[model samples]
Target: MSSVCVNQALTDDELRWVLTRLDSDKDKEVFGLVCKRWLHLQSTDRKKLAARAGPHMLRRLASRFTQIVELDLSQSISRSFYPGVTDSDLVVIAEGFKCLRVLNLHNCKGITDTGLASIGRCLSLLQFLDVSYCRKLSDKGLSAVAEGCHDLRTLHLAGCRFITDETLKSLAERCRTLEALGLQGCTNITDSGLAELVKGCRKIKTLDINKCSNVGDAGVSVVAEACASSLKTLKLLDCYKVGNESISSLAQFCKNLETLIIGGCRDISDESIILLADSCKDSLKNLRMDWCLNISDSSLSCILNQCKNLEALDVGCCEEVTDIAFQDLGSDNVLGLKVLKVSNCPKITVTGIGKLLEKCISLEYLDVRSLPHVTQVRCSEAGLEFPKSCKVNFSGSLTEPDVLL
Candidate 1:
């Protein structure tokens, strides 16, 4: 007869939504006092209620939380807050989230090896884990992950400078199923460290060692030889120690390679790149030679002439490439080329870009930022009409961002 009793008798969907919308965990707890049925409803409604607020508010709602499929406590927690967060707090959380798959703890600067080890205890189903930018994590912590998690597919540790070659070598032995791994900016990872990873982790399809200054020709050669048949994507950006020989080795071995990024590898000349294009011309889907100062348009032109399967090309800051490079791609009947970045090349003008817009009609994104000739030359003199469908960000004519898409 009472209004409270009348409201309590509503449909399950309405009751669930109502209980979830009630703010404060204390208030959510209050619902249980109403009846056993209401207490049952609170159990299911609390997670949905926690999801309504943002990710950081979940810990407040659920104290005994565990068995999470994906845990992204990355932005909410930092490394400094680690080891001290309590094993009981986590064990209660991890017990329910036994199905935890993806864990992204990026920028958790306070988290030490102890807290990492605690989390690793419950990581049986974890697949993709990114602890990138977590500065405090060392070999001790990574050893825990490598030992605990079995089916890890992707592991990213970019900019985690504390991670040495030892951590990588250890992972190669334990995490055998690792398909995609990123060790970018791990400066201590040398040729020997890379050798262990190359020889031990044979199933790796994508490997990133960008800015790993210590990795030299020997390391690359080791990887090229060991994982030749398996490697499909390789990134060595800012790894200046390796020269033309390593590149050639990669070309010989990684024939099925679909993506190769060697940006900022100054020692690698145009010759090896051309050889790579000649050998694996049809297989390479994405090629990024950005900031490689020695590379000229001749090799690139040769690549464009032959490798018609190019999907994404980044020649940004390669000052040697002139309008000729763009011309080769322009109206050359090249199919499947969608994204192109030719920013900061002084020789390319609006005329070449204009002509190419018509040719690369399929292009969805084009960035030609800071091209002196393009910005300096008068639009009328260039004789190129800007197209509509493509989002072109140029130094001269492009001003607005496309909003419709």
Candidate 2:
């Protein structure tokens, strides 16, 4: 019986296919150094490139990967490096990578509106642009983008505090295909601007106005009502002025809403939660109300009873939540419940969490940190172990229970 050869040389296409399966960029880059042929193939096939190696490195990358589609300079230290890519570096990129679709310049503090204008002039095909935390950019730069990148779909202007209604109005008029907009921490934005944007861009699906304190119920309501049927994910974290009225409007109109995050909206209460659960019950998947001090057991009970498809729930720092909230949650109705974060709820005990776990069989992540009575040892002593699928986070300075004499 003849056996296949143990060491057969692979064709170039087969070799490239194997290399393409590598998950990390560093691993793939290492493979590129193996031989000139491998290096050429790797460079040609590379579509996404992340840089923190400064402007010179970016120029080198642009020369190598001519067909690059996405470039991220988030300065996140993916390779334990610093990002020195300034407006000059962006000019180099904008000049070279015209085919770019997604460009993330997160935390690139050196980039100014001048650089953004350059990007707007170039990269017409760009769809997703994230300049979050680029402090120097103002409405002037954003208007440039609106004028140039008419096809832009997803824009992240988070931390660009200088931007206001003008930018939103420009985006609304030009980028009609706009779908996702992230305005997190843009404190200057008010209701009028957001309302203008939503009215024109009714197709928007995801809107993150997290920490936009100036935006109140009147402005957000316009968005909820305009894009009601089309909106899917809405984040209003730390938007203090938003109250039950805006939430009710959202619940009533955004019938297709899937993810709703209103964390730190202190004014919101059970009325908002119940309205949301009742309106988007079937479609709701993730709901986060962290730091919402007014929420209680009644709200959780309402969610469990109505939003059967809910998977992720975070009611952390809600001091009012207690064991009573978990008692009815374990019913067969919420079988899909997987992640539950009740951390900082001082009133919850082991018994309550145990009851909750018993019902939420699908739960994989359980954060019960700061609870008084739910120590790891106590859990073990009680003959209760988080199943292989569950990971329970514990807090508090209490030592494990003392062994019996």
* TM-score of each model, in listed order: 0.78, 0.86
Best by TM-score: 2
lDDT string, candidate 2, 1-405, tens digits = 977642256677887798879988789989888777788888988898876665677778888898899988776535224434688888989998878999988777788889998999998999999988788899999999999999999999888989999999999889999999999989989999998897679899999898999988998899988998789998999999999998899888899998888889999999888888899889998888989999999988889778878888889899998889778764465457777788888888888877776767787777778777777887878777565877777863333221100
TM-score of 1: 0.78
After TM-score superposition, what is the CA distance of residue 48 in candidate 1 from its true location, in Å? 11
Residues 1-405, model 1: lDDT tens digits: 645764557977888788768878789889877887777676644432222222234454454333346666554433344432333444544444566677666665656687678666776788888888777789988888888887888999988898888887778888888889898899999999978876568888988888899988999888888888888888888889978988899888888888888888877778998898888887888888888888887887777766778878888888888867657664446456677878888777776677566666577777878887675346547665554566667544665332100
User: Which ten contiguous residues of candidate 2 have the minimum total lDDT?
Assistant: 396-405
